[model samples]
Target: MKVSVVKIGGNIIDNVEALDTFIQQFAQLEGLKVLVHGGGKSASALMKQMGLEPQMINGRRITDAETLKVVTMMYGGLINKNIVAGLQAQHCNALGLTGADANIIEAHKRPVKEIDFGFVGDVDKVNIAPLKAFFEAGLVPVFCALTHDNQGQLLNTNADTIASQIAVGLSEAYEVSLKYCFEKTGVLMDINDESSLIAHIHQGNYSGLKADGVIADGMIPKLDNAFDAIGEGVAEVQIGKAENLLQKEFIGTSITA
Candidate 1:
């Protein structure tokens, strides 16, 4: 059995047509096992609408007691369910899950040395048992990054980081490919030019690009997660558009170990 795990960005899910097209392609794949991780754009939007200001420190959402509740309810509840519904509408048997399911993932509240952000978590361990059962049963497991400890306290995790961790876990568990799908085609040499997709990336060069400001801001964390995934024995990590799927000719950056 071949597995391909895709991490869909929250921004991409906001666009109706793009989401539909992506789901349509996913529906067409035959004998392919998929695991999806999505984010909390709509959840944040609702929070803003309700006059609950969202705070961010170093690009990670700051989840205080108040914000944590909204995030868990929105991301793990509404957003995850909607993604599953979107896939199911296209006849994809998708099951939405949180780290709580079958103790699928475990984490300790992240204690940052430089900053204090309440309730944010760094994934300590992923229990892949439930995931194996779902995959074996022919169900696509879609995940929200929010997870809990043994005492059952909900904690926030970086969606992309958690996605990469889950991809790494799935790859280790099943020995397959993990693809990071997002809005950008790949890491670009020139930020403004879409055609400047760097097709092949060496781990050594990625560091210099960041130091030189070629890869900064959002791309910085994303590339960092990609490197982590590649380093952890995922066969290959490609950052690309969902439209291209697994087509060989499609342009994207490939991270090879």
Candidate 2:
């Protein structure tokens, strides 16, 4: 069976209209699929509202104890359930999940090196059995950016990493295509110009692009993960805005291994 693992970032999650449009389009997709989402900005906003300062280094959250509490409430609770409910409204049998649910994903707390990302988890394994069962049962699994260490500790995980890991794990049973949906059309040549979209990228040229400062910031990690997934048997990988999913012809940056 063919499976499409779609990861939607905070750009779509924080906007009601964008999220509604994206979910409606997602519900129409055929075959087995999974939806993984990120809502860090929403969690951060809520944290600030509650007087907790949010901190980040190189796009990854510094996930302190207090931040973990807020993130769990936002990503695993509010944002996840809302997406599930929205998909259900569109007639999609969606099950909202965290890494703890059914122990679908097991992770370990990130070890301190140069920086200590408190409560952050590095995925140790993604158990594909339960996920495949859900697919066989005609259900779509919606994953949030939270994982656990099996030892009664919930940890914040990077959504992109989770998506890539899931894709890699399920590639043995399905021809998986990992699509990262965000606000941009694709990776751009010029950050200031949205029209400068790079439609194709391969490992050969990726380093040059980075050296030129074309693909920097948060996109660097995303593309790095995309390439890694492709190398690990994912059939295809693309980065584009949510609306690209609804188009008859896909216009996005395609990553090649």
Candidate 3:
């Protein structure tokens, strides 16, 4: 089976109309599929509402215990369910899940280093059996950025990493396409110019692109995850705006080994 594991950015999730539009596009995505979402915006909003100031180190959220609780309510409960409901409204059967549900994924708390990223989880394993079962049963699984330690702890995880790892896991059983959907058209040479989209990328020029500062900051980690997925046997990986998800003609930065 050919499967698409599509991830939507937190910025889209923060916008009501953008999220609905993205969901509509996603529902129309062909073949067996999975959805992974980021909810940092929602989580941060809620944290502020509750009088907790959100903190970050190097663009990654400092997910302390309190932030974990907020994210659980937002990412796992509100955002995930709303997307599932929207998919259903579009006549697509969707199953919303966390890594804890049915043990779909297991993760360990990020070990404390110079900075303790409290309660943040780095994925340890992805159990594809349950996912394969969901696919065979003709269900699309929508995942939120939450995972368990197999010890009753729900940890905050990076949704992009979760999506990439899930794609890698599914590659063993399916021809997988891992997609990173966000605000940009594609990976661009100039951040300000949409026309400068780097339509195709591979290992050969990726390092050069990075060295030239075309790919820097958060994009670096995202592309790293993409390359990791490619190296681990995923057939295809692309990054582009969420709006172009279902286009008959492809438009994005296609990553290859």
Number of the top-ranking candidate, with TM-score as the measure: 3
Clashing pairs in 3: none
RMSD of 3: 1.5
Global fold similarity of model 2 (TM-score): 0.92
Ranking by TM-score: 3, 2, 1
Task: Write candidate 1's Cα lDDT for 118-148 as tens digits.
Answer: 8877788887777888877878888787888
Query: Across residues 1-257, which tens digit of lDDT does each residue of candidate 3 receive?
Result: 89999998867888899889888888988899999999847788889999999989997789888988999999999999999999999988999999999999999999998999999898999999999888888899999999999999999998888999999999999999888888889999999999899998899999999999999998998888889899999999989988775575889899988
Q: What is the lDDT of residue 241 in candidate 2?
A: 85
- Estimate, for each residue in 153-228, the C-alpha lDDT of model 2 and write its tens digit: 9999989899999999999889998998877889999877889999999988999999999999988988888888
**lDDT of each candidate versus the true structure:** 0.76, 0.91, 0.90
Cand. 3 TM to true fold: 0.95
Cα error, residue 188 of model 3, in Å, equals 1.2
Error of 1 at 138 (Å): 0.4
Residue 152 shift from truth in candidate 2, angstroms: 1.1
Say which prediction, candidate 1 or candidate 2, comes out ahead on TM-score.
2
Measured against the true structure, the TM-scores of the candidates, in listed sequence, are 0.87, 0.92, 0.95
